[model samples]
Target: MSPACFYGDSSALDSILGISRKKTEGALGQHPPSVSYVKAEQDDLLGLQPDEPANPKVLRVAIIGAPNAGKSTLSNTLLGRKVFPVSSKVHTTRCKAYGVITEDDTQLIILDTPGLTSPTKAKRHNLDRSLIQDPWDSMKHADLVLVLVDVSERWAHTCLSSQVLQCLSRFPQIPSILVMNKVDLLKKKALLLDLVTELTEGVVNGKKLHVKSLSRTHLDPARNNPLPSIPACTPENAPKDGGCLQEGSEVQRGPGSDTSCDAKASDSGHVLGGTEKAQTATPQVSRDGKIKKGWPHFREIFMLAALNGEAVETLKRYLLMQAKPGRWEYHSKVLTSQSPQEICENIIRGKLLEYLPQEVPYMVLQETELWEEGPSGELTILQNLLVPKETHVKMLIGVGGQLVSRVAREAGEELMNVFLCDIHLKLCVKLKK
Candidate 1:
């Protein structure tokens, strides 16, 4: 009498039908162009049962970094598709989203979370508060962390944000990989070597990491064109990113290397003691004036351009190989867990960021009003762009409404590609009271 073991719901009809699946063929047995219904008993509902065998391995990786550090770009690249919206502005990602990678014997679940930044008193919207806390929330569920660093920046070595250092310090138990992103932008090859050496030695907070170096200089075998070369490009043959995706070999786990970090005591630093409180707050700075002592030891290091699909394949393979045996948390075929509405919101906001002036991007907000699906695989989306000032609205509208038209066109085109249907995107510019 255990409620008759209702899997999804106890509805009598669903219980009798077991599981209902939809098919493309018509219910009337029509060929080539209609839809139909199918019913099947799936053991997948409860996942692998205790008595059942054949359980595959699963790995959950969390990608965290500073705002505009190419985290969304890297997440899209690793997922081999564009689900997370990408833009040049900060705070592009407002929540944690999953990008699933299904392989033969493993499934890699990637959590793409908002960039870690300190909460500000002025920007205290619910969304802003969520953005600051989402990364730490996702960290609790991660098996491993991929820390992406913007290596192309001039202050890349010493200008590590205090927020990032605090995050790394808080999670000393979880193993992390240091990913040096945007290496292709380096004009000089020697600078890469110097940067790597300095990064390995640079003390953060106060602890110096014993970093193991396995640096690969080349983005790909085709140095000039890092993206994998495709045989041809046609309407039917083109890949998502204008080329084939690069697939690299996984890094084999070797004997334990000494990558452990030690805690130090100072006016602002805390000593490494288990559950023992220090008398004085650990001064984040050491004698050398390093910011904090809670630096994390990176188990693996990778340098690649996520935009160009460099070394991304290697990163994927490594994650797959690192998978520990367990029940998969998500379905194999599900690329993203974001709803259609959420996807549209991100896309529209991203487009707005791209076309608007720097000052105007932050002054604007987008919200989806309505979503309707047409009979012929078409979509009608109604969204409103709210601006604080009428001047901002005027700017967004442009002369003769040209700027809004451009955004609609670009967003519709990308939407059509992802949803495989014509999109009618209606954007209204309204002044916020």
Candidate 2:
């Protein structure tokens, strides 16, 4: 069949597109600044100043974890808006996206990054370079790091992903938190405690105690045996020489200077490097400098379901409280750094990922053909979905074009909600060649 085309109509398109519908008296064809710019300008005209606190605060948090670990969901929940795209497919976020939350004198900037993957796996799959570098870059600029783990997954109960371990080990200086996401899916509450114990290696509430062997049977002898008691590395007991003390090695550093620690060999013979200052509790590292268990240095542990937004507020409050005195980087009205076109593309991509079958969505490329304002203050958008193979185009269009239609309709509704205006969206599926 020929390429299928679908159209979406909604009322709030002009607002979302940052276009001004009201005409001024003096100039012809002179459009006003965007809504955000106008609002800021109005504030200036009215002499409206923020009630600045004694110490205005800002916190930049980087959320990192394995693929599909609810990082984007949590970020949207915290921001109280769905600016980030989310789907069941892994690597839905191709690069680092920023979400902003401003309350009173505090502004929290969330760095929603692409999921972490090993270098080999990334190269083998020919994934985007951002998938490997973005997380580290986010960590370098972050004041705090949230390590989100999908607790419902069985793999989480055994050990954290190697990529997660690498992140924790690399940026030991930044205060990190352990967020056990998707807790609502886990039925047995007792197993949650066991999983925590196993991950934390019997360290709870800043106290170290002997934890019995986990009830779950595992083939790895290292996990089955009782782990040795390692002193919890807190800032109070950290090395006085302005560096983190790990077992026998001393990470030396000058005062107020950031330095990288030498690469240490892991128990598995992997060499992990790029170390920073150690400010929090250190994870249980192998003698050769590899992380063997969960990061014990997490200043806090939170359990929440990002999908339902349960306990997310509590986490948000905690992060807010952690903010220190700093100037706000973004205006309070700004929700994200993404442009309108980027947002629309992500929404459509998310829908395609949700509606299309395995590997098809990943293989599809999206291009915006046209974006213009209609006479009645509606947005008209035309986008194309380019598939590499003709068979893939058939799959995207579905029988009688039902699949593509569903993707278009749902995406339009979401776009309408996001823009708060009427939108006319057209989608066409075409062969890439």
Candidate 3:
């Protein structure tokens, strides 16, 4: 099938590409589908059953942000365990959902997605960049969107990227919360006020966010504000129509939102913006089809650090309180939708991203070659780290394979903790021809 037809329709694409599936599968060394295409097929291929209508409420939350914004770390913190891998590198998470928190009355299925990036920057290499859009795609499947912003960095213009704005604009009615992550890293506490103002107004560098769609020549940051400044709406003045302001009452920031002195803080896939949900008017787009300037109005603001377990409980409580009359989508016991092999692959990849330098991490891929279950509930796993060049392989192996061994040791410890059993992890670095 032509590249244009690949994303047209799953069934049509599948039918047209029938002959190529075998060859594609073989080239990855009997590997599972590439990261870009796995989400499309994971559920259909696994045949995992949905929840049995036991719980009265279910909250499908989508955690979205730019690469290295710590979405995975937040997910792990929320679940009270590490089901997803946290990495400093970009695009650590492809498309994966973890049915993280389970309450007696509510089940929160967290959809962890790839970080959002500009399509042009993502597709520059022509490598499989499909996962770049996964965050936006996951937004359609979400009942609530937790927009994670890195507040540690100063805001020159807007807090969010254009990609995030475009996705939120597409679903104007879906209430979202602006979560200011890594606030602990903020050296100046007073800057928080400025950060909040910039995010609400969607202005950056004292100018409205620049988008390719609007007439760029007409917009002068000093002369005209292309995007209207959104009126600051506090919780007391929120709209009553269950629209823009409804999401604010759900979270209370700082020590006042039922928490003291610390701050912090979707579903395993059914596409966002399904027909079952109510639809609102689509936001205006520029003539060139580029996203017009408009900052998103968060339902509420949550400031928390996911790494230090700061205010994570407060965020969890807010989610539980969102429970309404609905059936749970995932089984009560399941923590994530990912298979064992996929989890192992993510774990190993996280280590490489942490330890490897330069372009080596991005050019390499890891796959679980074997997963043997022992009688005592232990797991023996073997994974291969595939590199494109011989030099890359040597970098991965280090001198006398010391680097690989270090990666293996750290990966094994985490695996043991997550799986709750003994793990013997073996890493093999191979140069891909």
On lDDT, the leading prediction is: 2
lDDT of 3 by residue, 162-185 (tens): 787888887877777777778677
Local error of candidate 1 at 163, Å? Answer: 1.4
**Index of the highest-TM-score prediction:** 2
lDDT of 2 by residue, 1-433 (tens): 2111000011011111111122213211222123221233334523444344677899999999999999999987787666688999888898998887777789888999998998898888778999999999999999999988887787655577878888888888888777778877775433444565566554433433232332233223665432221111222222333212122211222243222111111211111111223443556567886677676666556667899776575577668778889987766656677767777888899888888888789888999998777787677889999999999989999999999888888887767665666788889999998
Judge candidate 2 at residue 268 and give its lDDT.
13
- By TM-score, rank the candidates, best first: 2, 3, 1
Q: In candidate 3, where is summed lDDT lowest over 10 consecutive residues? A: 265-274
Model 1 lDDT per residue over 228-321, tens place: 2112111122233222212221111113311121111011111111111112333355676455522425555566678877656556666776
Ranking by lDDT: 2, 3, 1
**Candidate 3 accuracy as TM-score:** 0.68
